[model samples]
Target: MTATRLASVVLVLLTLCSTAVPDVARAETWEAVISATSPDGLGTATVHYQHLAAGDSPTAEEINDHIDAEANRAVTQAMWDGSTRRPWTFDASGRLTTWAITVSEVFTGVYNTAEPHMPMNRLGSVVCDTRSGIIISWDNLFSDKTAGLTRLGEQLETQVAAVASPTELRTWRRSGQFAPVDVNFKYWIPTREGVALQIPEVQFGRGLKVVIVPWSAISDLIAPEFLPITG
Candidate 1:
């Protein structure tokens, strides 16, 4: 072969080889069972999670690490020092079949003759069906003392749709008897690390009345531990 033709052939072969080779192989998904121990050492809770994509299962250890990272980011940004405990079980389809006993704490300031500060304890549970990517049930227990106060409040179910990489629109409503009051909340997910959740833009009631609030106004009330996951 001519030298010029041989050089062209070698260049073409190199280009094809480079194109065929991937820089990084895709990671396989695995199901993960995470058990969180409470900071007080009083209890532990477990949760099962898997990647949303099909044929992806992450190990329990990986899931636990991801949960810890997100939870830490959430709490730190909200300026709260709290932890959670839970145990979760997953089915073969990568759905969470059971979850139990997740507790959190916060500092509360009570006004009497003077400002008295106290630590408040709160407990909650998040149950979900991992296969369907649906949360089945949840409950919250609060330590506030009042006459005839109902510890359990409204049960809420949310359906979320990602409109963009950084924006998600959600339809949420209270389950059971409170179903009549449906609302829409829009979340702007952070594109960078260390930023917390923004104040959700709420369209309240069936009539869809829009209300906007500052992120700081509800930052303390929002759960900092859970952030949106992109599939």
Candidate 2:
């Protein structure tokens, strides 16, 4: 073959090789579904959930049950508050706030376990290994537990300081201070740029408090199993 012809062939081969390589960011996906909905004056409750669509996943029944439990809790809380609210008059009726909780199955990645593995994400992820049926907790997602905890704590603190204003922080300190602890924050949601640390609103008597930080800030703490999605 001619020198130019050979160079062209080599270039074509390299292009093909690059194109064939799989991108982890592109490979991750989740199947979204409305697990439950109830409008019986319980603040118009609705729960949207997501799961793995690729592999053997937790059954629909299981997913629905999870959604139902979360939905019911919101409804019950609203009902209790409504009953206790003052001013029981015609003008004061139907003005109560509604409940709408949506769980995004953000970032689906599979990890090695006993048996079949599936996509697991934040919001509704238990990292439930469908085959072995074992729920992977937040602690398990890190290779070095102590180091991971420290890294996560720092990231969260920085995010809170950056997002929460001075007034908000002072108010929070009085009623709901953000405690830097390992177990205090749970269920992290992986997004395109970073992960959102999920802190229950029950602690602060408000909506969910999310602390998002860049992956680079805590990249060393994240396990290889989650790199595909978190990347």
> Best-fitting candidate, measured by lDDT?
2
For residues 41-142, what per-residue lDDT tens digits would candidate 2 score against the true structure?
A: 222222333332222334423433443343333333333332222321110010101011112332221111122221111132333322232333456656
Writing each residue's lDDT as its tens digit, candidate 1 over 85-194 gives: 32211111122212221111111111111112212221112222233333321111112212101111111122122221222222232222213211111111211221
Error at 220, model 1, angstroms: 32
In terms of TM-score, which candidate is strongest? 2
Give TM-scores for every candidate, taking all chains together and pairing residue i with residue i.
0.20, 0.45
As a whole number from 0 to 100, the lDDT of residue 86 in candidate 1 is 27
**Model 2, which residues run further than 4 Å from truth?**
1-136, 163-183, 199-209
Candidate 1 Cα outliers beyond 4 Å, as residue runs: 1-27, 51-68, 71-231
